[model samples]
Target chain A: MKEFKFLIAIWKTNLQSAMEYRGAFLTQTIGMMVNNFIYFAIWIIFFDRFKDVRGWGINDMYVTFGILASSFGLVSLLFGNAFMLSDIIAKGRLDYYLSLPRPVLLHTVASRTIASGMGDFTYGLISYVASGYFTWDGLARYILAMLLAATVFVSFLIFTQSLAFWLGMMSNFSNLVLNAMLTFGIYPITLFDGYAKLILFTIIPAALMGAIPAEFIRAFTWETLAQLLLGAIGFLALAIITFNIGLRRYESGSAIQTEV
Target chain B: MKHFAKYWSIFQITLLNSLAYPGEMVGRSLMIIPFMWIFYQLWKVTFSTAGADVISGLTLRDTLWYLMLAETIELSRPPLARTMSENVKDGSIAYILNKPYDFMLYQFSAAMGETIFRALVNAIFGGLTVWWLVGAPNHPEGFIIALPAIFGAWFLQFCLNAMIGLSAFVVEDVSAFTWIYQKLAFIFGGMLIPLNFYPQWLQTFAKMLPFSSAMYGPVYLSVAPSRELFISVMTLQLAWITALTILLIIIYRRGLTQLTVNGG
Candidate 1:
């Protein structure tokens, strides 16, 4: 309970700081929302000409984007520091987190928030509705999907950022993997087969971001639901284990300042 | 003619600086392969649905090639807007103003140098990817037109981004402006699907915009290498360049006046 309170207080302070630049915050939020919307528009244009891709239509795309945008937004807004974890590790900035009594990774993630994620969260809901899948059951499934997707997204970041310990400054590699996942998430998964499909489910697991969740929502299956739950839990465990292993390799280098 | 040597030296420094970051270059280049793979799959599905070899006068092969070219152009451009905005934020523009070289021209040369190096890397990587996947599309005798056309496109893209960067004088952050500009270029400029696939009205609207000249012109010319088409596209690109350069000059003057008044 005390740890939760600390996390909330830090988030509140970050939100206040972000609000200090209200105009910039709002512009960034809306700008990112529109930036994501353009991807959907591109798909829309493609569908307008070609109508469907491997039986997946524009509406499937809508929900896919919806889940992706919302889950990503939630992570960025609430746990923005995950995005910069590699940099923090590479720079030996984990000293501050180590000094704190709380779980370092959790506190580190909750330390910052991204304002633009608000736009993504909003865009997600709007896209869900626009896709005409806002029924009560749909909403429930969507929420569940978002939960699993968000978990996978966070775990993915942790796994990538943890490489800083082994690789000794691999922020570039982390960023590369993250971007590849983003590129894969926006595409229709039905088109991928063979090794590419295997890659989507494993190494990068881009499907968690959009495809599997969207599929479950489009047509509910207990099997897929089980797979998503397993994938999320499995990936989360892997990330935590990897991070802890990396932490064993971490060394504080050239500390310039001391904090009690 | 004398200042050309200055720009050349700056370009050389920028090129060498980029080469120094080999890991970053390789990572960035490798990242594009999946994007192209996705595009390949999407276009294949679309072609299968259309039941025709030529929608918008592009075969699956042509569309795939077009996507590679468009992505090459898109990725080659430097992050001019972000760098400029950072300079403005940190009051480094003042230091730049005191430098011997023209700030805008120096930055442009740096951007051009970085872009050309990245473009060459992407061409090799993307070319190999295409050759392995779908084989290279046949080009007409006038394939040489693409060189100048693509170079012109890069300049136009840089000018647009630089204008957005200069807007940092007024705006707290120009990321929003950059995002809008990039999306406009991607959507209307024929980055993913050619403008030919767009509806007639959108096609006309996109044609009139400078974004199309920067992206669509070069990609289209690569596939349909007609000399008449090349000349017209190049002319359009030149006109936009002239107009955007004048706009950039006005923005730079105003930004400088603001900076001086505010004691940047």
Candidate 2:
């Protein structure tokens, strides 16, 4: 409860800071929405010529894009610091978190919020509703899927960021991995098979982000739910373990820098 | 002679700096594969669904090879607009202006240097993937035409990006413009879907735009080339290059006049 309250307070402050530059904040959010819209437009164009790809139609894309966008938005909106972890580590900026009273990793991950995430979340909800498949049961499955998807996204980021501790100056490589994962997640998972699908479900977890969730929502099955649950827990555990181990080797530069 | 030396020096330095991160370059190039793979499957399914030997004058092999080449064009362009926007936003562009070199020329040289390296790496990887899996382009004769056509396409992209970057003098950031232009290029320039697949009106509209010169012209030459197509493609590319270069010059001049600096 206390942690939740603290997170709320942090977001409140972050929102206030963002509001200081109202125009720029609005631009960022709207730009992201337009960016995502263009991608959807391309898919629509594809479907216009061909009815479907392997039983997956434009409607399925709406679901896939919806789930992926919303979960990504949630992570960016609530845990924006996760994306910047590698940069923070490279710059030796973890000292402030360590000095604070709360959990360093948690605080570090939830310190900032991205205004664009609001746009992404809004777009996702609209897309999902527009797909004409929303239901009470679908909503429940969607919620569960969001939890698993967001966990996988944050965990993957943490796992990559932790590499900065050992590798040092890993921002570029970390960014490349994250970009590849994001690109993979936005597409239909049915498009890949065999070894590619296996990699997606395991190392990258792109399946958890969109496909499995969309499938489970289409047809609620305990088996799929169990798989998602196991994947989330296993990935989260790996992230936490890697981050903790990396934390031990962290060396502070003792340079004073303040971020509001 | 001095001007050439100045630009050459900037190009050499930028090229050397890119070499320092060869691993990152290769990793960046590797990103094209997943995109190719996804498109490969989608096209396979698309062909099977259509139940036709050719759609829009392209066989399955032709479409896949076109995609590979299209992706190479997409991935190779330098982020010149972002670099310029950052330099302008931070007021570092003022520092560059104070130096002996021409600011626009310096930016162009730096972009060209990095772009050449990136294009080569992307082509090698993208080409290898196509050969390893999809064999080769259906039109081998078009490969010879694509060499100069692709380079012409890159120059056009550089000009467009330079103009956007120069707009930072009036706007807070040009990144929004960049995002929009990229999508426009992807859609109208036939990055994934060929321009011929579009309706007649849309294809005509796309042909008139410079974005088509940047992507469609090169990829079109690679998959389906004729003497008339070659002449038209090269002519359109040269014309756009000339037009955009003039626009870039005008923008740089006006942008410099309106520039404001803090701590003056």
Candidate 3:
């Protein structure tokens, strides 16, 4: 419990430091917002041309994009620094977190918050509201889906970052992988057939992260809900295992002392 | 001649530096391939069902070949002529300028070397993968006709990117310009979808724009390569490259003069 408090303190301090750089923080926030808005524009063009793609209406596309944007936004807001996990590990900055009296993973994640992520969150919320897909009837399911989506996204970061143990320069690799997944992954999973769908659900988990959960809410299916729950659990387990194995390989040295 | 040799040496060093990071090179190349493949698959589905034998004068095969060629070409081309634009803004350009070679030529050569290396690797592996999976273009002449046109496209793109980078001289923030240029390329250059897929008016407008030469013209050359088409596409690319290159030289000279005058 004390460790948890310490972790939270660390997060607060980092956020405060970031707030000090108001100009950079604001620019980055606006940049992320504009970056996400462009894709929304592209989707508008897509739906404009084809009224419905594989039974996916404009409304459904908006929901998928919103859920994805929001889920990614949530991750970025709370654990945006997690994206830099590979870099931290590579540079032996993990030693600082390890020395702290907290779960290293928790400390690592809580160390930094992205002010820019607020832009993504704001854009996503606006998109969801604008899509008019949100109704009180499906509110519970949407919230649940958002929670599960966040879980899967966090699990993905953990899994990818754990790769830093073996791959020294894994940050760029992780970024490339994550970007590809987000760009190609958010579409209707059903558009993909056979082994492609299998890969999306299992290896990349893009389907489960964005598409499946949104699909579940749109057309509530016990089967899909179950799959999502199971997938989240499975991914969490995998990430934990990967992190533990990486921890075994981690060498605790005075690397952070020099930085200090 | 001495300057040329120094620039050549810098290019060689850059190439060797990239070669040292073989794992990164391979991983990035592998990562990009799947996304390209997905684009191919999506376009195939879109074209397969459309009853119109020709969508904007492009047949199904033409469309598919266009996609394949564009994916390969986009990967092969360097991201910018002035990747060091940000470096200039942050004053790291000072270290680069202190080197024996001209800073502009050194960076340009480095970008070219990296692009050449990526193209060779991507072509041999990525080309075969696409060919084996999607099958080669129906028209054999298409590949031959596209070769020179593709070169022109690369040159034009490089010049335009350099121009965008040159904006650093005037603009306090050039990153926004870079972002806008890349987004424009993705949208207007037909990287997202073929220009034919756009409305007829938009298609006409896109073709008239310089950005289309980077994307649409090469795709057109690859899918339906005729003597006349090749000449027209290459001529336009050459015109843009010459114009942009001259503009770049002028801006660079002016920027340098200002830098010296201000002691920046």
Each prediction's Cα lDDT score? 0.85, 0.84, 0.73
Docking class of 3: acceptable
- Chain A TM-scores, candidates in order: 0.94, 0.95, 0.90
Q: How does each model score on TM-score?
A: 0.96, 0.94, 0.88
- Which regions of candidate 3 are displaced past 4 Å? A1-8, A114-116, A136-143, A219-221, A252-254, A257-260, B51-54, B77-91, B163-177, B250-264
Tens digits of per-residue lDDT, candidate 1, B1-264, equal 997789889999999999999878876777667778788888888888889888878888888888888998898889999998888887777787788888889989999989987888887788778767788777734346688899999999989998898888777388878887888898999898899999999899999999999999988998888879988998999999999999999998898776522346
Q: Write the per-residue lDDT of candidate 3 for residues B139-250, one digit (tens) a residue.
A: 8688777877777777777777777776665653455556556667767788767776777777787788888887788777778878898888888887777777788788
What lDDT score goes with residue A51 in model 3? 59
How close to the true structure is residue A30 of candidate 2, measured as C-alpha lDDT? 83
Q: Write the per-residue lDDT of candidate 1 for residues A23-100, one digit (tens) a residue.
A: 989999999888878867888888887788888888998999999999999889888999988888889888888876
Clashing pairs in 3: none
Predicted candidate 2 versus true structure: per-residue lDDT over B1-264, tens digit per residue: 865998999999999989899988987888777777777777877888789879999888888889888888888888989988887788787788899888888888888789878878988888887777678777888878888989888888888888888788778487777887888888889887888777788789988999899999988898898889889899989998888888889888998898775422
lDDT by residue (A58-81, candidate 3, tens digit) is 787777877787778778877776
Location of the lowest summed lDDT over 10 successive residues in candidate 3 chain A: A251-260
